[model samples]
Structures are given as C-alpha cells and as structure tokens.
Target: MFNIYKEMWDRRKMIHALSLQEIKKEYAGTVLGSVWGLVNPLMRIAVYWFVFSIGTRADNPVGGAPYAAWLAIGMVAWFLLNDAFRLSQKAFRSKRSIIKNTPFPIAILPAVQITFSFYTHLILLVVILIAMAFALQTVSVYWLQILYYDFAALMLLLGLGSVTAPLVAISKDFGRFLDTVLIFLFWMTPILWPVENAGPLENVVKLNPFHYIVQGYRDSIFYHSGFWEHPLYTLYFWALVLVLFILGNYLYKRMKPIFLDIM
Candidate 1:
C-alpha cells in the first residue's frame, strides 16, 4: 500500500498532465469551450431555484438567508461533492487505452477526475460567493466551514473512487448501476428540497447518509454553521467514509491486475 502510494506521489507531473488533458478534452468540440463549466452548474442552480422557490417551498432558509443565495451556496458545494464522487469512479472505464497500453499509475485516473471536479466546483463557488455578497447581504467569514466540508467531501470521493475505480475495471455493470442509483439518490437527497422538511417522510430522508452530507455543505456555507455543531453526525460521517476507503483499497488491490483482461 505504501509503495503504491509513493509511486503515485512520484508521478505527480504525469497525473497533473493527464488531468489537464482530460479538462481540455472535456469541452473540446463545444462552442463555449471551458465555459461549459460555468454554464452547466448555473443552469442547474437556476432550475433548482425555480423549483424550490416556485414549484415547492423549501424551508430551513440558511438562517435568514435568501433562498436563491442559500441554494447557490448549498448546491454548489453539493455539486462538487456528488460530481467528484460519481465521476471519479469512471477513471478506468473512460481511459481504456491509457490503462491497456501503458503501465502507468492507474491511481491517477481517479485523481484526475477529482481535480476536474475541483476546477468546476471552483467556478460555481465563485458565483456563489458573489451571489452571497449581493443576495445574502453579508460576506461569509465561514472559511473554516467551507474548508471542513470540502475536506470531508474529498475524503468521501477519494475513498469512493479508490474502491469503485477498481470495481469498474472488474465489473462494467457497476458503473451503469451506479449511474442509475445516482438518479434515485439525487431525488432522495435534499438538493431540490430539504430533508428536514420531508413531512411524514422525514424518517425516510434520515436513513440516507447523503442527506446529512448535503446538509453539512448547506450548513457550512449557507447557514454559516461549523462542523462541531453536530458532533455525533459528523463523527458518523467520517467513520463511514473511512470504512468505504478501506474496502475500496482492498478491492483495488485484488482487481487491478485482472482489470486489463476484463477491459
């Protein structure tokens, strides 16, 4: 494990280059180029704003925060976490040739996806900051909250990717199934609505760990709350994330050698 991690560390340039290449390739043929990063999330924010504000009333208003601004802050952070988690698992399947032709650090593929997730989230984060200044009528001094949630989200993604990337190599069905499940989870999560306001279905919302995660981001940036505010839940989240990583690493080690053949 130590050796694999060290080799990955030594190939920093290659990982950086691959991540850049993936970013360029991402919006290559599009008219807006890299601006798609800003555009897509902006569109999502607008949709959720219209839905919650107009379609249904979303409560827990970020401690006297504007709904638009609240949604922006919470959703942007949630987008980063979910996108990083969902897409990083695609590393092996997306780069079939890179894996088959070269004996490079397969680990970097997920990291590349994670880097792209960060880049896109940064654009949305900037927009949220600007919106917070204008709509919320206050600047956030919750830099530490943002950092805490970002760190927690990264752990979730890193651990998930480490496990899922290898699973994808061994089982393509895992990817397809994950995509299907994410659709269900998007609704099950409180992105378009608040889990706390689930009425009679509140217990159902409580069962999902993701609802708490979304709440974590929303609380951190939108409501200006700190990680320690909900000590028990926060500890639970990290513990679950750690278990995921441990399982992921074991799976990766077991499956990586046989990945190319299955691919």
Candidate 2:
C-alpha cells in the first residue's frame, strides 16, 4: 500500500499534467471549453433546486438553512465522488496507449482521473461557499472541516479506484455493473432525501461509506459539527478505508503483470 502511494507521490508531476490533459480533452470541442465544468454542476444545482424546493413545494428550511443550500452541499460532494468513481474505473483503459507503450506507473492512472475530478470538485466547492455566504448569512469555523473531509474523500477514491480499475480493465462488464451500483448507491445515500425517522435502517445507511462523505459535507456546512464529534462513525469510516486500501493494493499487485495482456 505504501509503495503504491509512494509511486503516486513520485509521479505526482505526471499525474498533474495528465489530469490537466484530461480536463482539456473533455471540453476540447465545446465552445465554452473548461467553463462547462463549472457550468454543468451549477446547472444541475439549479434544476434540482427548482424541482425539489420549488416544484414539489418542499422548500422548508433544513437545520435552520434553506433546503437549496443544504442540497447544494450534499450534491457537490456526491458529484466529486460519482465522477471520480466513473472516471477512475476506466483510467487504465482510457490511457491504454501509454500503458501499452511506456513503463508508466499504472497505479497512478486512477489518481489521474481522481485528480481531474478534484479540479471540478474544488470549483464547485467555491461556488457552494459563495452560495452559503449569501444563504446562511454567517460563517462558522467548522467550515474548515472541509479540508479533512476532502482528504478523506480522496483516500476513499484512491482505495476504491485501485480495486475497481483493474476489474474494469479485465472485464468491460464490470464497468456497466458499476454504473448500476452507482445509481443504487445514489438513491440509497441521503443526497436527494433525508433519513430522519428510520429505526434500524439508519444504522444500515450509515454503513455506506458514501454516506459518511455526504453527511460529512452537511456536518461541515449546516450542522456545524466536527468529524471528531462522531467518534464511532469516524472510526468505522477509517477502518473501512483501511480495508479498501489493503484490498486495492493486493489486487493491483496480483493483476499488474497481466494488465498488458488483458488490455
């Protein structure tokens, strides 16, 4: 695990360059170019705000903040995670040319995709902060917890991408399966809806790692709670992350030698 991360650190410059290339390539043909990255998420937020807050007449303030504000915080976090999952799964295949020809560190391929998603994530975060300044009217020191949560999210992505990237490379079927799983996870997570009155189900929902991230974002913004406050939940989250890191590295090492053949 350390070696995988060490390689990623050593090749950090390449990762940054490739991630930038990915962002440019994604918007090359569009007239708006990289502006679309900010535009796309803002548009989604606007549509969701209209549908949930205005259309459905569910505009009640949540936790003393506007529903739109609350939704934006959660959705922003989810967007990063969803994009990272989707892109990182195909990182190896997307850069197959480099992998096939050069002696590149295949492990960093997932990092490249995650880094790309993070660029957009940072932009969306700034938008959210600006929106919060107007909507909430007061800033709390707890907002700094975003840094911790961002680090947590990155670690989770790296761990998950490591495991799934190889699987997707091995079988395109896994990529399709992952899409279905992502949709299911999106609904199961408390992004679109809140989990207020559930009895035992709330505990089950908390078991979802994505829930930890989504809720962490909310906690940072609306709840004004530190991650350390939820000691057991934080412990559970890190324990799961550790497991994933171990499993991901194991899979990467076992599969690295055969990736060229399979691809």
Candidate 3:
C-alpha cells in the first residue's frame, strides 16, 4: 500500500496532466465539449426530478429541504463515484499504448480517472451550492464537511478501482458484472427514494458503503449534522476503506505483470 501510494504521490503531476488530457479527449469532437459534463448530469437530475417529483407525486421535502436540493447533493457524490469506477476499470485497457511503450506507473492510472471525474464533481458541487442557497435559504458550517466526504469518496474509489481495474483487464466480463453491481448499488443507496422508517431493511442498506456517502452528503447539506455525530458508522466506513485499499494493492501488484499479456 505504501509503495503504490508513494509512487502515485511521486508522479502526481503526471496523473494530473493525464487526467486533464482524458477530459479533453473525452469531449474532443463534441460541439459543447466539456460543457457536456455539467449538462449531462443536470439533464439526468431534471429527468429524475420530473419522474419522482411529478410522475410519482413524491414531492415531499427531505430533511426540511426541497427534494430537488437533497437529491442534487446525493447525485453529486454518485456521479463522481460512478464515473470514477466505470472509467478506472478501463485504465489499463485504455492506456495500452502507454503501458506497452512507457515506464509509466500503472497504479496511478485509477487516480487519473478519479481525478477526471472529480473535476466535474467540483463543478456540479458549486452549482448545487448555488441552487441550495436559493432553495434552502440558509447554510451551516456543516457544509464544509463536504470536503471530508469528497476525500472519503475519492479514497473509496481509489481502493475499489485498484482492485477492479486489473480484474477488468484480466477479463472484460468483470466489467460487465461491475455494471450490474453498480445498478444494484444505485437503487440500494437511497439516492432517489427516502428510507425513512425502513425498519430492518435500513440496516441492510447502510451496509452498502455508498449509503454512508449518500447520507453523509445529506447530513452536510440538509441535516446540518457533523460526521462525528455518527461515530460507529464513521468507523465502519473507514475500516472498509482500509481493507479495500490493502486488498486492492495486493491484487494490483499480483496482476500487473500479466496486464500487457492480457490486453
């Protein structure tokens, strides 16, 4: 873990540059270009707002804030995480030329995707905050805690990406499997639905690591609650992150040698 992270830290500048290059490459030919990053998610949010808020007639406020405001915060976290996970899995496959020819630090490949997603995440966050200022009409110090949740989300992505990227390289089928899992995770995560008084099912849902993050975003934005207020959940989230980080590094090291052969 130390070695992989140390190398990534040493090559942070390269990672940053590659991440930017990736963002540009992704939208290179589009008329709107990078604007699509913000536009795409905003469109999704509009669709969800229409569906749930209108179609389903579930217009109830969540945590004393408009449902749109609450939903935006959760979606902000999800967009970053989901994009990072999906893109990082392609890190090895996508950068085949670099891997074949350059002495690049493969470990940092996942970080590049995470950073790329993070750029858009920050933009969405700012837009959400502005929307909240108008919608919620108040702000709290707890809003700053979003920085903590963002870090937590990034760490979670790094750990999971490290493990999955190599596995996806080994078998493209794993990438498909990951897609199914992400769909399940999105529904189970309570992003679109309220889990209030969900009984024992709430316990099961919270076991999904993302539940901590989605709820944490709400806590930061709507509930005005500090993360420390939930001590056990906090500990559990970090413990899971630590285990994944360790295991991801272990798998990454074991599989990296075969990546070129498989690709």
Question: What are the TM-scores, per candidate, against the unseen true structure?
Answer: 0.88, 0.96, 0.96
Tell me how candidate 2 scores on lDDT: 0.89
Candidate 2: the clashing residue pairs are none
Residue 28 displacement (Å), model 3: 1.3
Off by over 4 Å in 2: none
- Angstrom error at residue 124, model 2: 1.3
Q: Which digits, one per residue and each the tens of the lDDT, describe model 2 over residues 45-90?
A: 8898899887998878777767888888989999999999999988
- Ranking according to TM-score, highest score first: 3, 2, 1
Which run of 10 residues does model 3 get worst, by summed lDDT? 193-202
Model 1: lDDT of residue 69: 69
- Would you list the clashing residue pairs of candidate 3? none
Residue-wise C-alpha lDDT for candidate 1, range 1-263, written one tens digit per residue: 43434555687677678767878988999999988988888898889887777877654454565667666766786788678878888888888997889876777778778877887787777776776667656666675567666777777777778878888777889898888877888777776656656899996676666666667766755666777887777778888887886787777777777887788
Better of 1 and 2 by TM-score: 2
Candidate 1 vs 2: which has more lDDT: 2
Once all C-alphas are superposed, what RMSD does model 3 give against the true structure? 1.2
Q: Write the per-residue lDDT of candidate 3 for residues 1-263, one digit (tens) a residue.
A: 55777778899999899889988999999999988999999999999989999999997987677888778888888898888888887788878888888977788998999999998788888988888888778888889999999999999898888878899988888889998999988877889977675677888788888878889989988888899999999999999999988888898888888877876
